[model samples]
Target: MQVKLIFSALTMATLLGACQKAPEPVVTTDAWSPLAQRYVSLVLALGEHDKSYVDAYYGPAEWAEQAKTAGQSAADIATAGSALQAEIRALSATDTMLRLRQHYLITQLTALISHAQTLATGKRASFEQQAQQLYDTLPPQRELASFDTILAELEALVPGEGDLTERVVAYRAGFVIPQDKQQQVFERAIAECQARTLSRIDLPQQERFTLEFVEDKPWSGYNWYQGAAYSLIQINIERPIDISRAVDLGCHEGYPGHHTYNALLEQKLKNELQWVEFSVYPLFSPQSLIAEGTANYGISMAFPGEQKMQFERDVLYPLAGLDAALAAEYAQFLKLMAQLSYAGNEIARLYLNGEIDAATAQSLRQRYLLQSEAEAKQGIRFVDTYGAYVINYNWGKDLVKNYIEQGGSEDERWQRFISLLSTPKLPSSIAWE
Candidate 1:
């Protein structure tokens, strides 16, 4: 009986040992998971380094940090809940879509990584050298023809402090406004913008006008990048809308402008892998050209069938609380002023880039922009830092506007434009009829 019991115990041990599974075969497949993780980490580091560039124009730092946390699904969401709660208490609250996008970016990355890993466990995507070429190619725009004319008109009004270049650059940079009137001018400018747009958009009366104003002056002319929200601030300066100039700036910075277009593209690229490459915002190449062109032209999209008269009489005049008769007279002057500004922007670009001289620069601004010496000086600083991008503002607008006109209906134009905007790759130039 003892021997039999011992035999049964031995047999059971053997069966248990056999039931234990052996280690599976090591599969050598292309895995993108590790690479995705590495890429996200790199992007986050870049954001940290570039934070200073966007400080004034952007919102609080906590919001961007919260977004960074949100973009990592592998981390515990509940653990970061407190940090997000803190961000909500700040001045610029995160919107629902932004929050969702943060997580969506990470989750999408997980899937991409998994797919890539299954195909080849070790291979990863490499960034191309062509990325930096976009920035290097930026050359200034020239408005020599108009600048010559405006110089004569403005020379008598304001004492010519030398030439157009110096005066225009200085004035544009906030040098012209008296210290006391700066805030007043800024406030009134913003108020006028809000009032102008309230009646134009097809929103219900109850849903009308909740325009959120941030300090746009500091970062008004620069490109915005993503960290937390797709854009931390609206670069839209609420200047008294000169119908034409307002439309030009509005299109470049607002609806069809930088903010709107970026938000749209970011939303489309919510996938993790896409965010790693595209959302980081390299300043050069076809990307800026396409982005600038589309945004510069967006004014036409938002105000299709818009007339210059309606812009001034209906929108701009009402916003400033001006009388109809006085408004009409002022509107014409504003239109001329704006066109002059645009033309001067071109001249600034040429002069700063060494294509033109200081004398030529001054001539260009004074003649084209109708600059007081102070204003022309302000414009000079702008052209120096930015280079030829000024041309993009007007040239892009013309290109897109013409394209839309030739393409027939607004919807049709948009359909074609959307296709262009949707690509992962950027085109060097926009095609127009």
Candidate 2:
């Protein structure tokens, strides 16, 4: 009986051992790893040359320190970028995600090299050429006359107009949030946006931001993404604080906009997957297209159709001490204005290409964008500073909207949108169809 028991125990042990799988081999070498490290270092080095080159960096401290002291010229940086591109292209990735990483590196390196060469040579391509090279997509050209129909529609909405621009401005002036109540209104708007976004997306518990109202800035709002899932958002009070902008800025700069986008990339790609290339964001690369596009589209995503108007009417209007009855009219006006968004891009194209002077550009902005003189000048200042970057907002929004809405339920749409945020997708890579 003892011998039989011993044999059974031996048989059981053998069967258990056979069922256990072998220990998986540790992946010690990834061909893309070194190239990714080099890319991060190169991006840091480029930041040394152009103050605006590096938008955000949260990589190794030593790498940044090394870049500051490298003393490489633009030509040298371009050469290095080209070499990196060659190395990246020489390697092929079979895995789906790995292939995406490889393509991302290749396209980004191409933009980096092109920008470096431009800096070194002191010569620039045409506005269209530069847009294509820098942003990886060209904004559709629209004739200025194409906006006349929208302007006429706005004219009927705000009748008895001396000029359509003046009438529209006079109408919207009633919707400005009082200076004293600006902070309160903005806080409420941001909180609502946060709640909506949090319900749909899972973000790091520690991720957060601080808000400040700033003056003398060209742009209306800006998000400065700090590493570690934090951001500093500044709203330019230099212009009138429109009640609509509370939700616009709330969603655009905070919830599902720049702040959320940066946090996800840091959390998912940089921290989780250890993709070092995401550590530094270059301002001029194709990534901005995705960033700005999604940020603008986020306003609509967070509040679809009449949802935004309802929120502003019921919640924000009372908070700002404005008449809520006119909310529907303002909503219609804004929708019409959105149709004319492409006009800004056309005006910028004309101005940058020297087809029109600054004065002409400002005039077109007033006539088309229906801006006050101060606002028109501010718009021109933005165009002067950002150049082809004007296209990123409207064009990028259209691209992202189409991609997210392509055959999905609302839940699936949110999932697709979040997927775009977490992945390394370029403008050219997004499926328009």
> Using TM-score as the measure, which candidate wins?
2
Give each model's clash number.
Answer: 43, 0
Model 1 over residues 1-433: C-alpha lDDT tens digits?
0011011112344434433332221223323223323333433432343342122112223444654655443233222323332333332316543333343333323322332232233222211111123221233344366455655654443324876445544433322233333333333433343334333322111111112233324234343444222232232333322223444444454444554455445444423224333344433224455567777555445554435446545655454444445544444444445556456555654564467877677655655665555445556655543344455455555555655566676567776566445444333223411
Cα lDDT for residue 16, model 2?
Answer: 44
Model 2 per-residue lDDT at 146:
92
Q: How accurate is candidate 1 locally (lDDT)?
A: 0.41
Candidate 1's error at 364, in angstroms? 3.9
TM-score for each of the candidates = 0.51, 0.92
Clashing pairs in 2: none
Question: In candidate 1, which residue ranges exceed 4 Å CA deviation?
Answer: 1-230, 234-251, 272-275, 305-312, 326-346, 355-363
- lDDT of each residue in 247-359, candidate 2, tens digit only: 99999998899989998998888878888888889988899999999999999899988999999999999999999999998888888988988999999889888999999
* Local lDDT at 71 for model 2: 94
